[model samples]
Target: MSIRTVLLHAAPDSGFNDRLAFAVALARQSGAAIKGLYTLYPAGVPRVGRALSIYVNELVREAKEKEGGLKAQFEQATAAAGLAASWETIEGEVASSLREAVAFADITVVSETPYGTVDDQLAATLPEHLAMACNGPVAVVPTGKPVPARIGKVLIAWKPSREAGHAVRFALPVLAAADEVEVFTVEEGDTTTADSGAKLAAWLATHGVNAKHRHVAEGNAGHAITNEVQKFGADLLVMGAYSRSRFAEMVLGGVTASLLVDPPVALLIAH
Candidate 1:
């Protein structure tokens, strides 16, 4: 689908600023409106202690000030890019708040790592949760580096699954805009009987996307995908969020978990 509106998670941190820049760049490219979301999770207060209540109130006040500052930053970035934008501040859980906002957004952008409160349980699995919570795609911006001014090269991790197809279809707009696209599938053993990449490439051609396909025999899918991203110098990586159950992935360490931990490039993921 065409990206008409982008939902961005705004915060008072370098990672969030980077994500805002990334979202602004995308909005400039697609002429999409920007919606900056800031969800506040105030510290819980008890009725028994006056001192603790005062401390919690102070923390909440500080958080509100930070949110106001972040809203200004988001506005500056979006206005500089000459994009239509809006901001929302909700007092609730991050995931649930974003889930409601994502319903109206075409694409959602977030930081690859935790944005605030390093020990935040919700931030820990944010990207995956966002992907699973919404029908749209989630763009996870990598940390510690400036996002590219343009997304030139895109790498598609093609696995024949419903989730993978959903990601590809949702990311069609980005794939068509990218200068280069590589659709690759990995095989665990030396089985050269099927080549789904070529078929997928042919389909993408109908959408005016010139893509190349390749097959790799690798035991570890996540490692192979990351290696390809590095070798190709991809600006964005598009793939499914999680093929297996989240619980199983947590214990067995799936591709989604590994990549989300340290994404090599901007990750566009869908469930």
Candidate 2:
């Protein structure tokens, strides 16, 4: 019932070190082994096209030095955390190596890519990036402040759909870890008519979770869920990452899209 191994994708810059330390601390608490995965792309691609930057070598020497420093820092962090950790430098084709690493470990946390659109691209390309990989659930931790600890209060965004079901299942560990598990369902379609929340509550009872069902009527599901989380003092959220047809998202953003941009609580999503 504990996280045994965690796979963390390290980044080019040192910003990722803080994330790694947090992961290491959690792993230590859970008696999990930490796997340090490094993606080694060709040092310093020409920033501009050959016409503009052929003469500019991009100072690859700086990249080389940075990479070395990063590795040393990773080792130091691992040692400081007092947990088992290993390092692997992969000849990366970017997302491909990440998929492989996620598949190789029990739990995966990806460092956000610097393409200026990783969050948007994450929803679009996650399937391809994961590629039927990852035997266990993965955590795509967005680059920001470190996730808070003592995750006792959790809000489950529930809907009668396969996506929502998978989200709940994938978040079983976290839910089991929480002291308060709120099954927050917003009005959508005939959800209340069919007593969808009751079914979910029964299922959770079978699994020994005393989850409370809260039905929110007449509001946006995403916003309602966020408000409910705040009302209940929830620290973590369990939700499904839903992808709409590219056209639908553009015309009017869906709950998933809105949540991705600004989730009130730390989210654990299953797509």
Candidate 3:
């Protein structure tokens, strides 16, 4: 029920160090063990020609080298943090490997993708996929920036949906630790009840979380959510990922898309 194990998608990329640092910090805060997962696609066995076989062999060798380096880095970082940690190198599809790794994890920590980079797009979308596939929270940290040492304040994007409810439940540990917790709801005309936000706040209170209810006139949901994060100086933003179908989200962007495109703060997302 608490954050006992944190799974990190450890990639040998430009943002590897940042992700490790952030994950270690969070693990320290929660007294959680860290598991670093490095996944690489195995080059398929070649049967047609020796030339193709040689190329595949070279790719596999390069992948193994990368994994070795990443493993060393993970060990060094975890040792420096004095944290209980484990590392795994798997040959499989990145998304599926992460989904399997996160099955036993209480939370997953990942770095945001570098914008407009084809190679980093997968890294960017990995958190979203994990949020949907894993039965826990996923913390997406912005790359190339120092993460907040402590998540003192949290902004929860509250909505009356099963996904939103799940996100709140998954993020309870972080919320419980925050000095200030705000349940932010965007009201669209007369559709939502005036006391809806209060109800969520009361629910959180039962779990020993003191949260304030804040409702704003419905504008762009994503903008409203991020605006609140900036206005309140929140270190963390908790919300459900992809409330709508992927196709629908692609056509008409949702809160998840907006935040992923330009994350304002560390995001704890669940689905």
RMSD of each: 2.9, 4.4, 3.0
Best by TM-score: 1
Worst 10 residues of 1 by lDDT: 39-48
Q: How far out, in Å, is residue 133 in model 3?
A: 2.4
lDDT of 3 by residue, 1-271 (tens): 7899989887766667877877887888888999998876532243368897686566557767888878988898889888999988887757778787777899888877766653375455777778877887888888776678777899988888778888889888888888999999988664573477789999899999999999887688888888999999998888888878866888987788878877888888888
Supply the global lDDT for candidate 2.
0.63
**Which ten-residue region of model 2 has the weakest summed lDDT?**
119-128
Which should have the higher lDDT, number 2 or number 3? 3
**True-structure lDDT of candidate 3:** 0.81
Per-residue lDDT over 192-267 for candidate 1, one digit per residue giving the tens place of the 0 to 100 score = 4137778899999999999999788766989999999989989889998888898899998899999998898899
List model 2 lDDT by residue over 218-265, tens digit each. Answer: 687777887897799876677766644534754787876666555565
lDDT of 1 at 139: 96
Candidate 2 — which residues are off by over 4 angstroms? 13-18, 42-63, 111-136, 243-247
How big is the RMSD of model 1?
2.9
Q: Report the Cα lDDT for residue 243, model 3.
A: 79
TM-score, candidate 2, is: 0.76
Which wins on lDDT, candidate 1 or candidate 2?
A: 1
